[model samples]
Target chain A: MSQLLRQHIEKITPLTDSEFTYILSHFTPKKYKKHQFLVQEDAPVPNDFFVTKGLLKASYTNLNDGKEHILQFAWEDWWITDYQAYFNETASSLTIDCIEDVEVLCLSLHNREKICAELHKIEHFFRRKSNAGYVALQRRILSLLNSSAEERYHQLLVTYPQLFQRVPKTLIAAYLGVSRETLSRFSK
Target chain B: MSQLLRQHIEKITPLTDSEFTYILSHFTPKKYKKHQFLVQEDAPVPNDFFVTKGLLKASYTNLNDGKEHILQFAWEDWWITDYQAYFNETASSLTIDCIEDVEVLCLSLHNREKICAELHKIEHFFRRKSNAGYVALQRRILSLLNSSAEERYHQLLVTYPQLFQRVPKTLIAAYLGVSRETLSRFSK
Candidate 1:
């Protein structure tokens, strides 16, 4: 499990064995069954979960309609959090739920800051990862603004074919902000 | 000009005078008139620009309709870049242009990495800023998914009233992913 995290960080910066071990000490491991909730709306969000195995989704449900909008999906080696709540130490504005049986190493904001402040390379690792995440979110915003349902479906398939294989089509529709009927038309 | 950059970094990590001076040395200052392009599609993206004065927009033009989709707007003290192209060292997929007469300090990818590697505090500063940007984008994605154009318009107004005053309504409509007619109805 820790190997997954070490590999993830090493992609951005090399870590000596002792450094890696020290870094691992900041995280606590936990498991969740498929459909378990890691975060729920209006509840305090305490940790950012790094998925060591399985899949999960973070979503917002519209208050009036109770319609779920999938904000993001995370599979193995990815991180998921209600970031605004986590950083602000406030109640969650979104919920995160497991899509498959999952194992994650959870890090609180305090531990994350402690690690970054303590290890220069660890700080560098996080900065690089955050930049990459920013670029990806920009691409998603562009797609949401410019792409048709068919174009979005094709783009999603090309970008994350694994997601298409693993996730239900209805959820993909939610992520793309398209109706179920429209999703069927494009996927067909 | 350097003061703005110094203050921006100091928000997250206080820098000694020499350190701020060293960091500022990596950046080059330039000015552009309203409507001038800083980054053009298919060209190399060599720098990330920090706005010292005026406003600029980064956008992708859909090939099928030649319609522009505003990815983001950068005002005084904000940063703008074709980040995917800048970080990956590839041709730009979007264009960044002045929305108002603009002055910016440009930092190459090499310089940014160099500064971050040389200064752990600088790396921490950037990581914090990037995390905040990630959270903002997530909020935008939620708004795009769940809100009506009027709701988005009101949200934008409440969040950034300065944008409503500075940007043209057409561009605001483009950013909202709503028809001009729809935007007119909401604004009127």
Candidate 2:
């Protein structure tokens, strides 16, 4: 599992074995059963999870109509958290829960900052990650604003075929901001 | 104008006079007339602009319908670019144009990486900026998925009241993914 993290980071910035070990010491590993919540709305968010196994989702539940809006999903080699809550040190406005029994390496904001301040390479790695993540979110926002439901469905299918296999149709509909029937039609 | 960039960076990490001067040397000051495009779709994106004066928007034009969708607006102390193109060194997918006559400090990808590699504090500043940007994009995605047009209108009005004064109603409509008439109805 730690090798997963090492590889992920080394793809951007190579690390000496001792340096990787030092950085790895800052993270704690944890596990969760299926359907367990890693983060709950209005609770403080302290850690960002880097997934090593299984699948999970982060979502916002609309209070007025009780509808779920899927924000993101994470599986192996992915990261998940209520990042706004984590960075701001505020109560979360999203819930994150397991879609499968899960294992993740958790890094708290304190340790993240500590390691980033201590290591220039680690800081560069995170900066590059954040830049790429920013670009992905920008593309997603453009898709939501400009694409038709069918277009969005096709784009998702092309971008992450594995997601269609792993996620439920209803959850996929929520992520694409379409009705289940609309998604069904596109899939057919 | 240089002070704006210094202040923006200082908000995250304090810099010495010599450090700030060295960083500023990497940026070139440029001006654009209103309606001029900083970035054109399908053209190489060479620099990211830090706004020192006036306003601009980053948007995509849907080819089938010829409708524009606003992705972001930048004013004083804000950054704007085809970030996807800028980061990846690809042809732009979006067009960025000035809404008002604009003055900006431009940083190419090469200089950005150079400064970040050379200065740990600059890397920290950029990482923090990118994280904040990621969180803002997440909030926008949630709003797009969950909120009504009126709700989104009110949220934008509260968040950036000055935009209402400076940007045209039609552009505001594009930003909110609503018709101009619908935006007027909400404002009334």
Candidate 3:
């Protein structure tokens, strides 16, 4: 499990054994069964989780309709959080729940800032990751605005085909902001 | 203009005068007229622009209809670019144009990376900025998924009322992904 974390960090920059050891010390490992909530709406978000295994989703619920809007899915190697809540130290506006049995290394904001102040490379790694996430979100916005629902459905399939095999179609439809019938027609 | 840049960076981390001078040297100041293109689709994107004056917008156009979808609007103290193109050092997938006569400080990828590698605080500043950008984009995703066009219009007006005063209603309609007629009704 530590090796998975090391490899993930190493993808951004190679770290020496001692360096990785120190950074790893700041994180706490935790596991959850399928259908567990990592974060709940209105609760304080204390940590950001880096998934080592299993799948999870982050979503916001509309108070008026009580409809769930899927914001993102985090599988192996992905980071998931109510980032605004985590960074600002406020109540979460989103919920993150496990879709499969999950393992993650959780880092507190204090530890994250300490390590960033300590290691230049770690800061670089995080900055790059954040930039990549920003670009992906921008792409998603473009997809939502410019593409038809059918076009977006195909795009999502092409981008994360493995997701279809793991996630229920109903949830996938929610992620696409489409009716289940509409998604089924696209899938066909 | 440099003071605006310093103040922006200092919002995240303080910098000594010498350090701020060194960082400022990496950027080139330039100005553009309203209606000028800062970036054209398919052109190589070379720099990220930091707005010190006036306004600009970045957008992608749908191929079939040639309809523009505004990705972002940048005014004084804001940053704007084809980030995917700038970061990847590739041709732009979007166009950026001046919404008003604009003045900006442009930083190339090479210079950006060089400064980030050289100055730890600069790296910290960029990471913090990126994280904030990521969270903002996430909010937009939730809004896009959950809000009706009327709700979105009101939210936009409330959040950035200055945008309405500075930009044309037709462009605001484009930004909201609403028809001009629909936007007219909302404005009424």
Which one is best on DockQ?
Answer: 2
Winner by lDDT between candidate 3 and candidate 1: 3
Where does candidate 2 stray beyond 4 Å? none
Candidate with maximal lDDT: 2
Off by over 4 Å in 1: none
Worst 10 residues of 3 chain A by lDDT: A60-69
- Model 1 clash pairs are none
Candidate 1 lDDT by residue in tens digits, B1-188: 87999888888888898998899999999999999999999999999999999999999999889898988999999999999999899999999999899999999999999998998898898899999999999888888889987999999999999998899999998899888899999987
Model 2, range A29-68, lDDT digits (tens) per residue? 9999999999999999999999999999999999998999
- List TM-score (chain A only) for every prediction: 0.98, 0.99, 0.98
Tens digit per residue, CA lDDT, model 2, B92-130: 999999999999999999999999999999999999999
**Pairwise DockQ winner, candidates 1 and 3:** 3
The TM-score values for the models, in the order shown, are 0.98, 0.99, 0.99
The lDDT of each candidate is: 0.92, 0.97, 0.95
* Model 3: pairs clashing at backbone N, Cα or C within 3 Å: none
State the RMSD for candidate 2.
0.7
Give the Cα error of residue B166 in candidate 2, in Å: 0.5
